[model samples]
Target: MSSDDTHVGLHPDDLDLLERLGRIAAVVDPVPDEVLELGRAAFELHRADALLMSLVADAGAAVRDNGAATASHLVVFELGETSVEVEVARRGEFVRVIGVVMAADQPYAGECRVSLETSASTTTQTLDDGRFAFERVPVGLARLVLDREGDQPMRTPWFDAR
Candidate 1:
């Protein structure tokens, strides 16, 4: 199916699901046919059963909820033979981080770091694409630090507000 074909134009079902998921203003962009094709091929080649299919669907949901299409900015990092792309967004009282990593020409292996810093606190570590989120971040000046170790660490020059 083409991307345009996948666009359902705000159906009732779509609105219901989005509301139930607490995502009212989130935009629902159509998934590309290429992505669906890749998912189907992966399932067929690897013999992924129903459980795996369910997991993939859940992951897709999370990706949608994390504002993949309207991401504020994407941080790209090249670290020791690996390239990582991270999507960042401001969600409610915290900043949501989502990312995918691939070793040059290889399938995504899922490795990256997302750090949020305030004057009083700082945290850092590698995280799965669906896993990194900082909560209760004080409403003040803060910085987002994306570190990939071997690569030059990137800092978002301390912006005010959550």
Candidate 2:
């Protein structure tokens, strides 16, 4: 009766039972689309030596009396001694993102390139005075990635742009 001494095979009934369990679980507790998207984005490949940034602050955007959204959605991300501050603003049917990179102990004066990535597209901008901006960006799950010459790359966690 020891299975280690013989070859084992799954019966057709076992697969049926597993499928039934999966269906039941799906109905009882299904995974949210947002969670699934974040999970996928989190697993996307980046530089092996890249440092992952942590989201430190996220201030949601405000709505005007006419139901129009205004800018000033501030989001901050940090890793090690470096931090990135971002502002997300709604521009008509799109969004605008502006960011600045900073080092806690000193001014960031390196040649840095920032990229705003989403499931659909990616937009890149070179830092001007440690700042960058992306206008007319699609509204969806997005993230920021920074690459500096001769330095470790950094990336922020995926966030909703809407």
Q: Give the TM-score of candidate 1.
A: 0.34
Runs in model 2 with CA error above 4 Å?
A: 1-43, 46-49, 65-67, 105-107
Lowest-lDDT window of 10 residues in candidate 1? 50-59
Against the reference, the lDDT scores of all candidates come to 0.48, 0.79
lDDT, model 1, position 142 = 50
Q: Highest lDDT: which candidate?
A: 2
Q: Give the C-alpha miss distance for residue 111 in model 1, angstroms.
A: 3.3
lDDT of 1 by residue, 70-133 (tens): 2244555554554545455554544555555556756344545756666656766665642455
CA displacement after TM-score superposition, residue 69 of candidate 2 (Å): 3.4
Query: What TM-score would you give candidate 2 relative to the actual structure?
Result: 0.68
Q: Lowest summed-lDDT stretch of 10 residues in model 2?
A: 1-10
The digit string of per-residue lDDT tens for model 2 on 1-162 reads 112212248566766687688889888999998998887756586444668899999988576747765655889999988999888887565788887899885547788899898876777888888888888777777888899988778889888786
Candidate 1 wrongly placed segments (more than 4 Å): 1-110
Error of 1 at 26 (Å): 40
